[model samples]
Target: MNWIHSSKRFFNNFQREILAFIHRKNLGKLSPLYDDSKWEPGHWYAEHYQRHFAPLRLKKLKILEIGVGGYDDPKAGGRSLRMWKKYFRNSLIYGIDLVKKKALEENRIKIFQGSQTDESFLRDVLAETGGLDIIIEDGSSSNEAHIKTFKTLFPALNEGGIYAAENIHHSYWPSLSGERWSSLAKGSIFLENWIGCGGSLDLNDPKTLMNMYKRLVDGLNYQDFLRPGYSPSYFDKHIVSIHFYPNLVILYKGNNDKPSNFIENNALRPFVLEKLGVESLEELGLEFSLDNSTPECTHLELSKR
Candidate 1:
């Protein structure tokens, strides 16, 4: 029976390698391969990932995905890791999970066991990987975990790399809060009451992962912010673009040094009025009663200087 199972596994792996080679040769759709796997259906993520990943299919890359599937079962997961392996022929695939999935280790694939929010664990993983070309946050699916893991691992992502968060709809679920729930008998409440209390669904909540990423959108235009002695956050200086999809967000990492057309050194240039086809606010049918005491007016006056 062991021999039979080994033969079957070998045959499956060989078949997949052949299919993957043909798929790469023909520029085939990834949806079929995703649908064939236990990771997820093609409709959920394959197309969106294809749009972003297809270009890099031939590149030798190191990719990390958080949360190997099958939960606490050590030997039962690695479906998505296998999918990624087939998809990126030239790439090495790595997965992190709380469970030790040493059984899933294969050629060009590795697994690490640790909390996603642990910087030390992640740093050690990076030591082995050198640096990551892509990172997919599919762990735990809690708001706090998303934010913390991103903060920990994003800095290690290579320049021009891609960082993606998956299952972000969990950010809106009341059940999965910033931390995992112990049980309803302890401190957790009923779903109805949780919703009634605004729960994690509140868009204004800073603790939610979606809101955290939304804040990064402003960082994309950090140069346009008008303030004295303004300093750009690390994200503001590095996050070049962010794309939102259903249950997913992809952030492109690179130099975000594009200066604002109308501003330089955090001061509005006088030529901005000319660019707007107006010499002054009055010409543009706009009026402001400047009050020197107000910070708004002070910035305005400073811009004029």
Candidate 2:
């Protein structure tokens, strides 16, 4: 866009062949949601990945992508990590994987080879990147890796920063799922994975009396932040909350508490917000394409807390 307005569009389109390859390998692993037309994450949750991260205008910040594999391979979606550099100009985008490969090497993409379970390796990366504004863990598809990384980095998260773990459904898979420890982390509070404690907000069941209190956890109260009607951020008054069908979501962590639902605010401290980066996404505008004509992939419950 710096050169010409014409440059604005998805820079890549060779995703179809890569999609075909992933499907053949998974062999209908996505049959549950695939309607003989669209594809699911196969080995990787593709649509959900875009839903969760692609939209945010992360400029002038540091982003760490753990387990970023071959973007050309179906799992990595034959994509380029340099796009992250595009999204964040003053940003230092780093990618770490078990093995260092080609897709791992892209514009401004710092590569690190190590296990997420290794504390020294993680610290070394964080130390090199200086600090992170966002951390996306899409590695090995292991729950242990997710948990271990979270324990190590969540506290390191820059105030109102974002820490995202893709394919979290692995947390439920018996073997790789590991064990559900406590709600405590090294520095951050472990939020019950959206499905955790008090998460069963079934429409069939009546709203609990306690959740209707005046002082919501994160803010003054639901009524205080209301503009008049619209249900006030829908029970849980998160900044940008979207629960797309089965599993996909995009939520901001404000100063709230653990297991906070509709009324309860889990934001214990203030959020960081983004800095004035050289590459501000403000020009990018809002990227969530909700147009009806654009078919949205239904979210699948891959992992639950």
Candidate 3:
């Protein structure tokens, strides 16, 4: 048994070296590198990744990818880690899985065994990595896990870092995604039966990772929200951009403090009314009272008429 394990280890290392040699000259696109490492195919995710990753290819980075490829079998995964290491030549690639994969670790590549939803374990990993420049959540394919892991890890990511959620299409699959659709009208047979028939693609499902990310989009414009005393959530203040792809969602983190031209201190500025050729708030169809001391419309009250 010991000899068998040794043979497997020897063959795996040998195969890695051979593949490395074969693809040593071709380092143009990440898709080819994925193929070289026998990870997910190029057609699946290469284009989107290339668009985002190509710019950071040369920078030294710390990247963490949730859900290393193999299941239960400690020796079966790490394909994508190798691919990432090759693509980001100056990066430290870290992967986490439910099963221990210590055998897969190599220079510039580290593996941790833990559940994605375990906050403590994630924090420990973050401490070891110091901080993350990029995080790719490809674990479990469960929307619940995706959302949980994201909320826990995204805040730990460095400013201007990239956070990506893969397999988000699973949000539509009731069985695999663990997202529950709201119950339809019990009184209406047609509406109740039609709900979740083929699979729920409910954009309103707040539980799904997709909708959660979609909601974060509004955060990018937190400066423009007209609500009084509205405090931007951590996500709103830090999430600078959100990009949605087929089964992927990528978030860019940065300061989101850009003020809206029309608003000041959360109130609509008086100049906006002048630009609209309105002498008063009434002329603009906004039933709002101008502060007796200031020209700015501090309180808005819509006319019933």
Q: Pick the candidate with the highest lDDT.
A: 1
Q: Which candidate leads the pack in TM-score?
A: 1
lDDT tens digits, residue span 155-243, model 1 = 77788999988877776766534423334324322332233222275767767778888888987887876543466677878889999
* Predictions: Cα RMSD each: 8.9, 18.7, 11.2
**Candidate 3 Cα outliers beyond 4 Å, as residue runs:** 1-43, 176-201, 273-305
| TM-score against native, each model | 0.76, 0.44, 0.74
Clashes of each: 0, 19, 0
After superposing candidate 2 on the true structure, give the runs of residues whose Cα lies further than 4 Å from its correct spot: 1-58, 71-80, 176-254, 257-305
In candidate 1, position 119 carries an lDDT of 69
Instruction: Kindly list the per-residue Cα lDDT of model 3 for residues 122-157, writing each as its tens digit.
Output: 767776787689998877656666777787788777
Order of all candidates by lDDT, from best down to worst?
Answer: 1, 3, 2
Residue range 168-231, candidate 2, lDDT tens digits: 3443333312245333322221232222323113322212211211122323243322122223
Q: Rate the local accuracy (lDDT) of all candidates.
A: 0.71, 0.43, 0.70
